[model samples]
Target: MADHVLDRPPEGAAADWTIAQDWSAYSAADHETWDILFARQQQQLPGRAAKAFLRGLEVLRLSKPGIPDFAELNDRLHAATGWQVVAVPGLVPDEVFFDHLAHRRFVAGNFIRRRDQLDYLQEPDVFHDVFGHVPMLADPVFADYMQAYGEGGLRSLGFGALDKLARLYWYTVEFGLVREEGGIRLFGSGIVSSHGESRFALDDPSPHRVAFDLERVMRTRYRIDDYQQVYFVIDSFEDLLRQTIETDFAPLYGRLAALPDLGPADLLPGDVLITRGTQTYASERAGG
Candidate 1:
């Protein structure tokens, strides 16, 4: 969902990258778009998405309709987990982004995509930011993981390993899966937010659903323009938090830097295969 990363601050701003949501500035059309996208995804996510993600929706009252006001949403979120959603012009610099997360502030873009762009948009907007990501912040474990990631991001800056660390975010925060009590379920915001990807990630069988491996994931490249060829699965939120927070990434980064990068579709012999993907979907798309 985070396709843009602003490297510099906007002109004539008091701060580096923060902006006002100006919630009232949104026209009727914007609110309607939220309603449409929200309703559409809700229908698709019921069976396919992680149960925690669904519960987050209700916990935050995301179902109340229209683009959420940051102030209002913050009231509930801050109460529940000390996490609050804030407004951003778009993507902020890496440090700014990490700082916000480190402080439990989630930045959301102020705009919404047009009706025609409903299916896809390269850059993240409010719906993509808030609707896609914020719900999971309702979960105590996920909230802690996000904060840990932010703190980790700051530390990672020193290791000269943001690229490797970013893949961890991509495979987990944006496009991860979980094995629930019944079956595998979608947890990544990127999947939960997309009507097409939600179904594609789970039921397609064309993409590999590999179990979470920190080193393998960091060494792997991911696709931004098409459906992910692989999705990493976690045992639970605790496992993910423990893996990232407890482990010192410095040595891991040094070792990974020397290793060759794995393509989005590549599966290592040692990979814990959840679904051995055929890559049919990616092939067909590439052909056309």
Candidate 2:
């Protein structure tokens, strides 16, 4: 989620961009905002969200009234998987982010979105960072995938493929879907965290649901301004971790450099189509 670079830490942040959660500073209104956002997503996600995420929510006991105290949240998180959540000013520099993940520390923003912005916000607020992302961190296999992604990100910098590598994170960590026993389930933080998208990603006919291909994903383009037109589905967390841990991306980077990138909605000849989207939703959005 740390997608941007900061010239330096803001006035109060540490060198690594870490800041105290300052949990006590949150107003009752802020707590109400978290509760409102939480209630809606909880209502939306059951059967729609990945089972691992649900299990993580139960394990972490994030059901309490207010925004979680990081100290308490970390105790449950660290106990489940060797991971802890730290507060950050906002998006940290990419390298700083990789370093944090490489060591199993997840950086989250300390603020919540205002009440009016419950549906959307330009910057990821605390709810999106913690409620949207942390639950999955409790899963052992997914936790390893995140660490592997960080280690891979550090390596990608030397190759000047951060943008391409970023597409991997955008597609998987932020907007990915996974095939479970019953059907495809939402695993991506972007989808699960969003009440609108949690349903649209699964029920709407406008977006393509395709199987995950590492290189194809790296070469694809994604939209940040709206709901995704496509989502890449993984076989399982174990398969994803296996692929990421075992692949050597240096050679893959070289090959990808010469290929054309795919648009968010482009359906290719080789794509494994799970749901061939009509793209009616995106088309209507553009028309309006």
Candidate 3:
């Protein structure tokens, strides 16, 4: 379970929570884990991830050696984008997460993954949080999209539409792509963070990359335990904001309520299909 947003800090607390970010507690092995992951991802991201994401890496000075000090990173981030990263134990509650995002404060899990779990980790660690997410936050359009999503999240909570809204976040923030002059480039944190997924997402023929449709996305399902079966593609971050911000979601939610949910790889009549995936990879997984 994620941490709840409304939970109050203890009385007269020196900081917000008791989980003092014992920086020294990080052993040499832990630092090694960060270094290895950082080096690998940095090498892989070029030509794969969006330009803005790469620029963010330079701006944050994250390309330097060893694990980054959160305090130092925040100082630079706050100055650049009015966004700051806060350390949390792991996934926090929906409201808590939304509240932080609404205020341009991203709550990242402070821990880094152990070397053994490099390929996959069930929970989001510093690699997933900072490496995957932070870079894009530097872009003004993407930054606005995130803050708007946060406000929408809080609104969705009032309407009991968190599940639907979460699907949007998962697809857009976690695994979405954007069309560029050269070709489609990665923007979603999930795709940017994974070495294999980065290649698979662009090079493979097993998943459909369709133009982003808000109504379709809200009714679509996503996979958590494996690679994404379908990915939504956007023209630009500006397109994302223009489409989403101009429309009120109340009616859209009502419209989606009457429709059936789409499976991970399933394409519909409404989709602006880029590729009709063969689904060979997904099918093999199903068989196995």
The C-alpha lDDT values of all candidates are 0.89, 0.92, 0.84
TM-score list, all predictions: 0.96, 0.98, 0.93
How accurate locally is residue 261 in candidate 1, as Cα lDDT from 0 to 100? 95
Candidate 3 error regions (>4 Å)? 1-20
Task: Please give the clash total of every predicted structure, in order.
Answer: 0, 0, 2
What TM-score does candidate 3 reach? 0.93
User: For residues 1-288, what per-residue lDDT tens digits would candidate 3 score against the true structure?
Assistant: 233544555443224332445567788888888888888988898888899899999989998777778878878888888898877765566776788889998878778887889989988998899989998888888989999998888888777777788888988999999988769999899899898899988889998888898888988899998998999998899989888789898888777778888888888887899877889998899899
Question: Model 1 Cα displacement at 65 (Å)?
Answer: 1.7
Deviation (Å) of 191 in candidate 3: 0.9
Candidate 1 local lDDT, 12-46, one digit each (tens): 43385777888999999989999999998998899
What TM-score should be assigned to candidate 2? 0.98
When 1 and 2 are scored with TM-score, the better candidate is 2
Maximum-TM-score candidate: 2
In terms of TM-score, which candidate is stronger, 2 or 3?
2
Point to the candidate with the largest lDDT.
2
Candidate 1 lDDT for residue 44: 86
lDDT of 2 by residue, 103-194 (tens): 99998999999999988998989999998899999999999999999999998889999989999999999999999996999989888888
